[model samples]
Target: MILADTSVWIDHMRRREPELVRQLQTGNVVMHPMVLGELACGNISNRSEHLRDWGLLPRVEEAAHEEVLSLIESRQFMGRGMGFVDMHLLCAAIGHGVQLWTRDVQLRAASVECGVSFTETA
Candidate 1:
């Protein structure tokens, strides 16, 4: 299973690239609540439609606030600014035991440092 990150979703939603379209069409993409929240920040209102289009319901997970906080602190200590959404997504990925699919280099690097599995593409 793969946790589709907001960046890739945004690219798929706005650009409709054939590659992203094909990847998402494969029925392997899943999402967390944080990704839904980010999508909500955009113009999307039909949550069901997005979920259907993405091929999975939100894979809900318990809040790992402490671990997420630790990750944020570590990233800050290492000079990266507070990446709140990225940390939340990472927390969700860790909880779900799935690889995070994101194009954000910093988040990918931080995921490595935190021992979270992640990938740049679907």
Candidate 2:
């Protein structure tokens, strides 16, 4: 199982490479609720509709706020607080024990601490 990130969905929508789509076809793929919201927040309604049409299912993960917060305390993220959405995704990936496939640089950089393996498209 893998926690697919919003960046992958954006790639799919843009017809970038279909990596996630291909993975979904053969393996278990999940998306965190925050990921869904992030993807759906800025776009037009039609975009959300298209996502639904594409069978985007909401992924449920135990929200662990403290663990993420502790990570911030432990490691300075260049003296800036981590974004909430990114933090949630990290927590979800850790809780689920799944690798996170994303194009997000911060998430990739923090993969070891977050316990979420990250992969990028070639």
Best by TM-score: 2
Q: What TM-score fits each model?
A: 0.71, 0.76
How many Å off is the CA of 81 in candidate 1? 3.2
lDDT against the true structure, each candidate: 0.68, 0.68
lDDT of 2 by residue, 1-122 (tens): 77777777777767745667667777668767777777767574477576684455546575778876765666665354458677767767776688877777677777665667756455
User: Which ranges in model 2 have alpha carbons more than 4 Å from their true place?
Assistant: 44-48, 51-58, 75-82, 112-115, 120-122
Q: In model 2, how large is the Cα lDDT of residue 76? A: 64
lDDT of 1 by residue, 19-114 (tens): 555555775556687777778678764767875655455474645778778756665633565367778887777777777777787777766765
Which residue pairs come into collision in candidate 2? none
Q: Given candidate 1, what's the lDDT at residue 77?
A: 33
